[model samples]
Target: MTTTGAVLRIQLLGPVRAWRDGAETALGPPKQRAVLSLLASRPGDVMGVENIVDAVWGSDVPRTAVNGVHTYVAGLRRALEPGRAGRSSGAVLTSESGGYCLRVDPADVDVTLFHRALHAARRSRGQGEAGAALRLYGQALSYWRGEALSAVPGPFATMERDRLRDLRLTVVEEWAADMLAAGHHAELVTELPAAVSEEPLREKLRWLLILALYRSGRRAHALWLYEETRDLLARELGIEPGADLRTLHEHILTGHPELLAPGAGSPLPVYPGGLPPGTPGPVRLPPVGRDFVGRTEELARLEEVMRGESARGGPTTPVVVVGGTAGVGKTALVLQLAHRLVDRFPDGQLYADLRGADPERGPASAAHALEQLLGGLGVDGARVPADSAARTALYRSLLRGRRVLVVLDDAHSAEQVRPLIPRGPSGVLATSRRYLGELAARDGARLETVGPLTAREGTRLLAMLSGRRLDERGPAAERLVALCGGLPLPLRVVAQWLAANPGAPLGALLEQHPALRTRFGPAEAADGVPTGQFHVIETS
Candidate 1:
């Protein structure tokens, strides 16, 4: 009988190697080894001879490819089970239904073990087990002895080798970030430069190297590295360093305290809800209104402001305070703009309701607002500082070099909004009932007053929300818009009531909810300008 009782171990991670019963076995020529590697990639999965030939030779297929496959299989069967009769069926590599399946346990494959360990490492990191994650990462990295699938011939092997190399780099980068967070910068200082040397164009690796050096008290070296990177990036790609690298350089120059390593015995920050580093940041913008209608002019103006000083050829962060009476759709307008411009801000878009108009809760204190904002930034609640000023400083420091959009809804005052504003190139869009003139004068915030929709826009909004075939020019729609004073909230409420109770007339709905008709009280804006003959209903 063949020596098949012992478990077979296959290593496809580095060079193709096989150990049968703890002894290395000859795997034949390169094509035969390529065939074995493909099967090992998916242990126990049946692979057809045609598919194998295609993967091995790609377009330059040989005329005797099928015969060549049979020859390779015979060779593998003889090497893997020398005791089997020449004409007898093989056990380790079996042929069934015109396809071959390497019937081996997946755990015996080094690639499978590597992937499993990497997954576990990410899980541990997400659970705030930084020490465990570091250990697991090291275990996963230990699987790679050199380039994966080294010298294994085939299109499949080439593609898989590239993919595996990329995964290795990703794990390395994530490990470096966790190391820095856990105050192990000294370890990274020794390891990261080698990785950077191998991937000189990868800015993130260089960024981590600089940060690790800085935290390890090599400030001069870190600065020199940044300048070196700037020159390298310019020379190779003909472009300047990205926003993140530039921001990190600036902070390093000033010796920003936020860049300092975590204190001894302090807990390392968990992955943002366990997400892998470099994963997209949290998307916190509230859902946009489905039946939101016009505001072409208003949307364009806000978009320009949200574009920050970029559009104006300046270098200041943009803060636009949307001021208007309640129920005028200021929040809706800003949220819509934020969603449209989401692709521009890859870091994240953060939102918080300041509760400026919440009579029960009153305006949320600046300190409370900063806490909520920090939470969106992935800061652990317990880690937040108690002092308001310290929290604000931390908040600003976290935002350095990131392109985030901060949307503060229903803000109370300039003071309440100021502390929550993000630093650097991030933009802020805040809505408030108050005009916040003080904000404009002091903080250079551009004030955009949201007024009631025009009669046409309001009529269209009602039709869309109610899904009715109402005549845009009909008296019924005109009276409805005029009674609602072109304010989106009351119009929406009336439309929803009509939609829910299909037979309910607009008049009957208005009579039941008299608050819907309260918007026609004044034609004055919050700052005393004539705001057309529109009524305003305060919304929570």
Candidate 2:
């Protein structure tokens, strides 16, 4: 953990340690440190007792191992959160069925921060944000103090040490690649020699160093280093230089114009985060189904509101909230609308899974969501303000004067999405199970409720999922819709069940999947329809 003002900071990138209010708290013996490191390795996940035991003691079963793990966790909890009292839920560590979890935020763990920064840097570099990529990559590489998990004793810590070191080297290599593309040949000429000496046979660094040297007008020295690498490989591994290094050597000899500029004048035209360049790159909207059924009126209404008018399309509205219960297909409708209207917003598109009501991760904090949004817009993670207020300001500044579409999906509340809303001509489309009344009242967000798909739409979806023409599907399709209560998720599941069994009737297919059958089974009139599962509907 980097620790600007966080209440607690834990570091596993170098050693197992804790700090609170500028003081290092004592973590007991080797076993206790190993347990904390293992739990921190999977922050927020419940590490099963058996898994922790295997990590700590290996296959040697001690009768006291489980009891020992319990004792260590008790000690860790006390040290991690001293404010919490006896028999109460500790803020840092908590017990769950059959095991325990260290419920610390990823921002408070150096390991998690490194991984996040490295991935974002890769994405930024992919999108031709050379300067932004370098900053992110540099921030990611800053977390390595020494060998990871150096103070913790166990197979898990030992393995993690090697893995983290290897990861750091890879990030360094990637950073070199970006630097070369950005015309940093002279800088590399100075920075790469020590790294080469440390890992003499790492071909990527060698290739990069050779290119950097050649580009820096040191042809004689570059040729000498190539021979040096070749000799090292031949001496240690008894193999010739691989094709990549050889190709680079040839390119340097011939003065390939490709090496003249960053990204080889081949800035990945694609938007960062995998959205194709011409489309809204930030939007997380899923692919729309080709056989998407109705919602004709609903789609029109959404498009109209997004255009800043009523259904008539006149005035300027900055936000649109699509509200629906579990399986009314609000997300699908919004995604389809975004894809349809993407060309209108030439600036970009942004999407976020707010994880509202998520069973595993719970509701995502707005600050975390904003960081992702900011990164996608070419802001460095380290440069992202630590406070939510400043982060929100920066996000809005990036979106100002640009016409973009921001989709906040599965939002838990207006407060979560409030800071994320665009304050410009760039419009937003948000989906939630609740109506988000505050948005309508405070932000002038137009709300549209998505109801269960009409029976016809559900029938069409079933036939499409089953790989049969809608007209050719059996009469049982309508009956299946009744069984599904016109909900798209369960109906889609039933369609898969049918596709799996050739010539199987829909009713017969239900028998094969007891769980799906339980949910999709015809409901008694007196018992009423089940409220259904919000978690599965949103997540699945």
Candidate 3:
């Protein structure tokens, strides 16, 4: 006989809910909730009748409590297995050994999924793939909608709640590390302060904020972060910063090169070839540009920086900065570089859009980026600090010695990218529309400017994208290149339009679509290319 796929799920940690399939089952009485909570905690593990009685009644057990417990268990079994309530399928709650056990898969329990994600994220870190590891951790922590067992009552719920809370702190530490790896230092400045306030005992988080402050060029603020964290740790935990944190503070105070070093941080965890436990399914990247072309010189420069060795020796990685005008292929070049360097940074590569120059809202704060990065690192929500300084310090500490590639895409300026710089010997690549002159002068950074592709390059790119032999198309291909302004972005956009409208003739497309003319405006327009298409083409 085929077994029913039905399983009981209790969520007391957040809002309380119990269900089998789409049907709701009433968990009768206070004791019934308690019984369910107990079984849920140790699903598949048999609990003796006496242990269940004590867990429910504690020291206030009554003479007839045994009979009441049995009645409650029987009712729960019926409610859980409504279809097999009276059948001999022996499913739902099963009789085992001396007592009974809830025979349910660990994934059926929310707590189990949460723990599995956390563990898997940790394992990813162990494998030196910090970027993938952080994402897994964040996915796992997101499963929690609210407090653990929020609807459940009794001692069992209370105990499990505390345990999950403790696990949250470890998650926070991992998250801080990931943010630092991802180059979100400026954003962390705002968040670390709040994190420290919320988690006063976590000295590691305070150190993270300090590092963020220092790297963001707020030397005083960075120092202040250390002082505040030190004070809080002393008053609350009656302890001092851990060895790693203390060392980081000294490095900051003495102006250690490692503090200013590119990608100087711990290696984040890596994904181990499967969806983290409890995830609905595999996480997939969204569809981005496919007809990407040109920017070869820019890509080569980024590749050199990513592969360059640290001058200070001891496995130091180089830092490369790419700056240019809007629509100049900065993002494209960096992304391409990241893909190429994937094998080198086996720990995994991380990318974040800093939005430094956004006209509307200010650039994303370092703290916010840190929070997201930390979440990716498997740091639990409850454990993440409310203070920015703590978060940065924790971030730096985590990166003390790991090889990972971090790409900070669309940065506004050097300050925005500073604190987010990792410390160890890993690689860091940043792209921005504005020139970060000071960063190059002060930090020994290599700046590469990306402009329009060469004519030959543009024609080659068009031919490759069109999937037709350029030699065969000859003049037609040249006309198409002339129509694109030699700008990769526009070329790719036009190429995609062509690929999608395969049946349409090129001459007809050029005649009907005003964008084709506008894209190659007067500045770069060839003698015969139209300008109206440039105006018509929407480049969002």
TM-score of each: 0.50, 0.45, 0.45
What lDDT does the true structure give each of the candidates? Answer: 0.79, 0.74, 0.65
lDDT of 2 at 249: 57
**Could you give candidate 1's per-residue lDDT for residues 1-540 as a string of tens digits?**
123676788898888988888889999999999999999899889999999998899989989999998899898887777777879767888897877988888989999999999999999999999999999999999888888888988899999999998899999999999998887898998998888987898899999998887776555456557767877888999999999998897776344556767874432232231122345676889898678898899898778767646344344678988888778888999999899888767778899999997878789998998888878866667766687876676666556666788899998888899888765678888998887888898888999987888899988888887768456667777778877788888788767766787766656654543455453454455566455655453543
Residue runs of model 1 more than 4 Å from their true location after superposition: 1-276, 311-315, 506-539
Clashes of each: 3, 8, 74
Q: Lowest-scoring 10 consecutive residues by lDDT in candidate 1?
A: 267-276
RMSD of each: 23.4, 26.3, 21.5
Pairs of residues at least 3 apart in sequence or in different chains that clash in candidate 2: 181-262, 282-350, 282-351, 283-349, 283-350, 284-351, 308-315, 309-314
What shift in Å separates residue 146 of candidate 1 from its native position after superposition? Answer: 54
Total clashing pairs in model 3:
74
Predicted model with the maximum TM-score: 1
Candidate 3 off by > 4 Å: 1-297, 311-317, 357-362, 467-473, 512-514, 517-537
What is the clash count of model 1?
3
119: Cα error in model 1, Å: 49
Error of 2 at 17 (Å): 2.2
